[model samples]
Target: MSAETNKALVRRFFEEVLNGRNLEVIDELVATDYQEHDPFPGQREGREGLKDRMTMLIEGLAPTFTIDDLIAEGDRVVIRWTNNATHSGTFLGIPPTGRSCRFAGIDIFRMDDDRLAEHWHVVDQLSMLQQLELLPSS
Candidate 1:
């Protein structure tokens, strides 16, 4: 596929699959043997695994987590965004704080055969916890 086509495929993958809360898009956009190098551990393999993860995230952080400044380059897309969410639910051993916080990060994606084959992410994890008052600021 052309680079442009690959870029479009990735866009659809995110919008229809992740943000749209549609797991069927995975079958359309991702290959059967899709692999993801997630920074967070315990995420299962294959598209079903990804769907489960997304469901957990959305349910846990309703109306809070969002993706912005999303852009694509060739087969790779760079996304810069902020997550402004209230700590009303458990996350990474942190209890609810009832405080909303904002943390920003960037992620780079590489597609394989027009499917989301791999991902590398860098997020402000420490900053997020600090903002949520779950950790002391460094």
Candidate 2:
């Protein structure tokens, strides 16, 4: 696929899959053997694991996610995103605080055969925790 197509696929992931809360699209957009370099706690492996992780996130945060930027080059797409949501469900052993939080992250995805094959991401967890009042801000 062309670089533009790859970028579009990534966009659809954030728009239709994440923000839209449509998990069905994962099977079509992700490879069967997808890999996540930064797996969440208790997160399994492969595309199924990816689906599980997303499910947990959606249920826990009920986030309104937004993609701030997207860049694609040679079968890779990088996305900068922000999410705003209330902590209504447990996440990473932290019980619900019912507080609103905003966090940003950057993800790099590798495309294989027109599907997402691998992913690596960095999220502002510390800031999120602080926003939740789980940690003191500096």
Candidate 3:
């Protein structure tokens, strides 16, 4: 697939699947053997695992995502993004703080035949935790 096409595929995963609450699209956008290079604590594995993770975040954070930047080359797409959300539901053993939070992250996705085959990401968890008053700010 072309670089633009690869970027589009990854964008859909964020725009549609995560932000839009269209979790079903995961099957369409992700490979069945999908691999998350950095899985969260206690997260499962494979396509189903990815779907489960998305569901958890969407429910927990009720986040609205914005794609800040998208760059693609070969089969890899790198996306810089931010999300603003409310802690309306539990996430990662942290109960809902009813606190609003904003955070940013960068994710790199590897495309295989137009589907996302692998993913790696770095999210500003410290900022989010501190904003929620779950951790002391330095």
Candidate 4:
């Protein structure tokens, strides 16, 4: 796909799937036998399965987080921003602290035939833990 086309695909994915909270978009953006290589949760198959996992992630930190600085290159997009939210739910075995926290990260996605084929992403998990009081605030 052209760079602009790829960028549009990503924009739709983020806008409709992620930000819009529309799981159905996954089917349109992913293959039926999509392969997910998310290290945080092992592996999953099918677009619906991926949507389920994403739903968990979003619901776990909803109304407090949004994707920012989403830029695309070729078939990949690099997102740079902070996930700021109040810890009102459990995460990674950490209880709610009601503490607001911010952590920045970059996610690179690879597209295949206009659909999201794979992803390689990294986030500031340590900073999030610290903000949640699970780790030293220093």
Candidate 5:
């Protein structure tokens, strides 16, 4: 796929899968042998692992996730995103605080045959923990 096509696929992932809470699209957009370099706690490897992580996220925080920026080169696409949500369900052993939280992250995706094959992310976990009152504020 072309660079533009790769970027579009990533955009669709954030829009349809993440923001829309539509797990069904995963099979269509992700490669069967998908891998996550920054796997969530307890998450396994492969496309199923990605689904598990997404399910946890959708259940824990009712977020309005947005992509702030996107860039594509070769078979890779990078996305800068923000998520605003209320802690409505347990997450990684942290019970819901009923608090509003906002966090930012950047994710890089590698495309294989026009499908997402690998992912890596750098997220503001400390800021999110602070917002959830799980850690001391700086």
Candidate 6:
């Protein structure tokens, strides 16, 4: 697929799957044997693992991401995003605090045969945790 097409696929993942709460679309967008380089602790494996992780964020934090940028080179698409969310449900074993948080993240995804094959992510988790009262603010 072209770089534009690869970017579109990743955009759909953010819009439909994450914001729209449509987990089923993961089957279409991500490879069945997907690899997440920064898997959260206790995260499962493959597509299901990705789905489970998304579920936690969507359901727990009720997040909505604003894509700051999408840059594609070859089969890789990189996304820079900011998320605004509320702690509405248990997340990472912490019960709901009903606090609101904002965080930024960058992710790189590799496409293979038009499916998302692998991913690497970096997020400002410390800020988010502090906002959620899980960590002391500096």
Query: lDDT tens string, model 4, 9-58?
Result: 87777677766778888888887766666733532566766776677656
For every candidate structure, what is the RMSD over all alpha carbons to the true structure, in angstroms? 2.9, 0.8, 0.8, 2.5, 1.0, 0.8
Q: Go through the candidates in order and give the clash count of each.
A: 0, 0, 0, 0, 0, 0
User: Pairing residues by index, what is the TM-score of model 5?
Assistant: 0.96
Please list the residue runs of candidate 6 whose C-alpha ends up more than 4 Å from where it truly belongs after superposition. Answer: none
Give each model's whole-structure lDDT.
Answer: 0.67, 0.92, 0.91, 0.71, 0.90, 0.95
Q: Itemize residue pairs with steric clashes in candidate 5.
A: none
Using lDDT as the measure, name the better of candidate 2 and candidate 3: 2
- lDDT of each residue in 4-73, candidate 6, tens digit only: 9999999999999989999999999999999999887778999999998998888799999999999999
Q: Which of the two, 2 or 5, has more TM-score?
A: 2
For candidate 1, write residues 7-90 as lDDT tens digits.
577667656755676777777776665566663355677766666666655544432435676677667777766767666665
Native-referenced Cα lDDT, model 5: 0.90
Question: How well does candidate 3 score on lDDT at residue 86?
Answer: 91
Best by lDDT: 6
TM-score of every model? 0.73, 0.97, 0.97, 0.80, 0.96, 0.97
Q: Which stretches of candidate 2 lie over 4 Å from their true place?
A: none
Q: After aligning candidate 2 to the native by TM-score, how far in Å is the CA of 5 from where it should be? A: 0.5
Q: Which stretches of candidate 3 lie over 4 Å from their true place?
A: none
Considering TM-score, which of the candidate structures 4 and 5 is the better prediction for this target? Answer: 5
Give the per-residue lDDT digits (tens) of candidate 3, residues 1-138.
999899888888888998889989998999999999988677789999998789789888999999999999999999999999899999988899999989999999999978999999999999999998899988
